[model samples]
Target chain A: MGKKIVLTSGKGGVGKTTVTANLGIALSMLSKKVALVDGDIGLNNLDVVMMVENKIVYDIGDIAEGRCRTKQALIQDDCFPSLFTLPSAKTMDNSRIPPRVFVSIVNELNQDFDYVLIDCPAGIDEGFHRAVAGADEALVVTTPHISAVRDADKVVSLLSTYCMKAVGLVVNRLKGNLVTEGATMDAPDIAKLLRVPLKGAIPEDEEINLSSQISKCKDKSSARLAYLLLASYVDGKDTKVFDCASDYRGFFKKLQRVFR
Target chain B: MLKNNTILRLKRILLSDKVNMPSGLIQLLKKDLLKLFDSYFDIKEESLKIEIDSNADGEYDVSIKGVSERIKSPRFMR
Candidate 1:
């Protein structure tokens, strides 16, 4: 059976959905069959991030309520045929799918894919528990900001009670310039503070933001490379993360930073 | 300096009761403690205090203290 992992953040807008979509594609590119599940039932957006919003005929709610089969709810990706997405219902009603049902759905997906990535909703409420109930491992995503870090810490503390196989941290939107200037904590420091293993550090990139909002693809970027490394790390490979502060040091680089 | 200050502030915030335990949970704990203490002595509900302090190892130290008016009449062995 495949491993089921949940991508979660205690605070919103930390790139959980974006990481889920891109990392799913990245893992698929690595010749792994990956399935992305939009666990944010009320505020579903993973379908949009994967650019498969128009193709979702049945959602997770249908599968949970026995309205349709699991295969009917899954949308196969066009670019990466090995990747599939199970989008959440667009309406807000937490009672439709209990935590145990969500667990069963993900367990069913585990039989087929190599990795099942669940894009969890923001905050530590019912939605968070529902998403986490099915996962064998968890990836807590947070930005470098103090608020986000603190929230991630609380989440780590809570996850300890669940006895998950593994819980790692992904520092998203890390500002390389700020880290270089000593204005903020970097990925390692943030991970250390939270007392969780660092899975990946995704730098703040405009290309990532643009690709998440629009259905446009871009060439190789720092965030994409970081996600590739993260995928490998999740696949049980010891990979060295690419440096995010490489472009903010030295004389010529300082000039380039000032220009951009 | 900003990074250090943020780390320090975050440490303080994490130790706060708002993050460690919600107000509702604290209230329930207080109620349960009051009931347990009432069986032994007269507990002052208004004076009952629940404190969560941080130890050197960054672990929580919960203290529940109260001033009892008097001990309840002993009838356990009767």
Candidate 2:
């Protein structure tokens, strides 16, 4: 069976879906068959991030209601044939989907893909419970902001109750210049505060914000590199963390920073 | 300077009892426990109290205190 990992953030708008989409594609780039499942239910939008929203016909609700086969609901990525996404129901209520049903769906996906990445909805409510029902591991995503890190701390404590096989952290939207100038918390420090191992740290990049509209990030973007590094770690190949502050540390960069 | 302040504030927030215990959740837990314990013991609903604490390792330490006047008959046990 493949590994089932849920990407979650206790607070919303922390780039959980973006990380799921990009990480899924990166895993596919590594030649691993990956599945992305949107667990957001009524507010589902992983399809939009993956740029397969138009192709989705049968959603997770359809599969649970026996209206469609599991394979019928999975939409293959156009750019990466190895990556497939199962979109959540845009109209279905989250409470209507039982945790066991989501578990079974993820179990089914595990048989076909090397990695099953579930994009968890924000907050520790019914949606959160259902999203994490079948996962062996969790990746908590947070920004460098204090509020985001505080929410992440609560999430880490809650995940401990779930007895997850492993819990990792992904720090997103890290402003490199702010960290180098001591204006904001560092990504690794946030991970340390949450007591979760740092799996990835993505520097703040406009490419990521644009990737949502364009369906894929530029190949040369630093966000893409960080995601690839994260994927390599997930694949058990490497442990090198991306240096988010590297660009702003040099003497010449400091001069540029003054003008920036 | 700002990062250090953030770290200090986060430590205080994480260490606070409100964040760790969440009184509202504990109330709900007590309600359920009351129902379960009432099956075998003659105890008042308000008699149950639960305390939860997280240590340095992030592990929860939970303790429940209650008083029961007597146990129900074996025939009534469920």
Candidate 3:
């Protein structure tokens, strides 16, 4: 069976959906058959990020409700035929969909795809519970602030109850320049604080927001490089994920490095 | 009766920490606790003052009292 990995975060607006989209694209780039499931039921946007929102007719709820077959719901990406997305129900209430239904949907996807990445809704409510229900693995995304880190820590603690086979951290919106200026915590520090292994660290990039709206990120900056490295890791290829802090070298830091 | 260990764990914990309890445990407490709490207290749009004190028997006694007066401050919720 393919690995069912849920991408989730406790805090909202931490780019959980964006990370899911980029990872889906990166994994597809490596010639892996990937399926992106939008687990955010009421506020589903993974299709929009994947640029398949226009093609969605039968949503996940329809499949679970037995109104449509899984094949009818799967929207194939034109850019990457290997990448498929199962859109979430836009009008359905999150509490209405049972965990067993979501699990069964993912199990079916696992038979065909190499990777099933579930984009979870923000906050640890019924939506969060439903998202991780079918997953053997999870990546908790968080920013490098105290509130976000605290929320991520709570998520890591809650993942124990679901009993995932593997769990890791993805620090998003990491500003290396701010870390160098002692304004924000570095990815490693945040990972250590959360007590989860760092799977990925994506830097703050306007390109990410811009590209996902237009298309998935194609530029070779810190954000894209980090995601590609993450994809390589997920592909079981031995690769080091990029450190966002390495890009920043201020005048004082340069002088300090010179002195050292 | 709530154990001392349970109270100790509850101390200084955030809402996210306490809210994610097992469904079985929540169901076990909800029905009994909700009915019991409803008899004595009603939720009002005001801050509550709670006090906990240890008696001579070394058991914690918890009390809850609603604030009668409302604050007309701009930062009432904050």
Candidate 4:
């Protein structure tokens, strides 16, 4: 069965949705069937990030309420084969899903894909619980700031109880220069501070701001490579870990090596 | 977005990668984390520019909001 993993953050606006969408697309690019679940419920935003909001016919709410079948609501990408998004309901209905329902939906998705990435909402509320209840693992996304790291630590501690398999960290918006200058926390420092395994680190990108209108990003974009590296890591690939500092240095080195 | 060789490298790793974390499983922490966030946001709502809009897609999309919009916390230093 494909892995059922939830991407969560304790605080809001930490790029959880961006990570989920890119990871799903990148995994599917490897020909692995990937399904993305918007676990935010009432405040569903994954569809917008994936650019499938208008395509959502039957949401998880409909499936939970027995109004529609599971497969009916899936929004498959025409360009990216084997990639699908199970969007959350945009309405204000009670977004609280029972644990059994959440598990059932994830289990059903797991049967058909190589990976199921759940986009968990910020905050440790009922919505967050329902999102994490059905996952085999959890990936907590955060920045290098003190508040973000503090919340991330709690997320790791919280997932220790719910995530059956393991809990990992994806340090997003890492500015290597800032860390080097002591302006922000570094990736390894955040991992050690939270006591969670470091799965991936994403460099901050301006392109991510424009991604909501268009569902895709440039292939060579820093955020794209970071997310692809993350997808590779999640797939158990031994690819070289992403080096944010090398973002500038490595580019020139590769160019020099090519000429040599 | 990975090169063909990079994808192959990933496939080889997947042959043995099982989503293992160094701190795999531990005693559950429950709402202990929630308490920490609540206290941090408790008396700082005024200085903190918190925004939670569901319709900000294609703009703030997944959330151009959260705590990243210039709300530096003072507790980390103290």
True contacts kept of each: 0.80, 0.95, 0.00, 0.00
Q: Please list the residue runs of candidate 4 whose C-alpha ends up more than 4 Å from where it truly belongs after superposition.
A: A212-215, A248-260, B1-78
The RMSD (Cα, Å) of candidate 4 is: 16.4
Residue pair clashes in candidate 1: none
Best by lDDT: 2
lDDT of 4 by residue, A122-208 (tens): 899888888899798888999876567667767776787873697888998887556544555667766765667888888877787
Give the lDDT of residue B60 in candidate 1. 77
Over A60-153, each residue of candidate 1 has an lDDT whose tens digit, in order, gives 9999888999989999988789999999999848878999999999999999999999999999999999999999899999998888887898
TM-score of 3: 0.73
Clashing pairs in 4: none
The 10-residue segment of model 2 chain B with minimum total lDDT is: B15-24
Q: What is the DockQ score of candidate 2, to 2 decimals?
A: 0.58
Stronger candidate by TM-score (1 vs 3) = 1
**Alpha carbon lDDT of residue A260, candidate 2?**
50
**TM-scores for every candidate against the unseen true structure:** 0.80, 0.80, 0.73, 0.72
Task: Please give the CA lDDT of all the candidate structures.
Answer: 0.84, 0.86, 0.78, 0.72
Question: lDDT, candidate 4, residue A50?
Answer: 85
Task: Compare candidates 1 and 2 on lDDT and give the better one.
Answer: 2
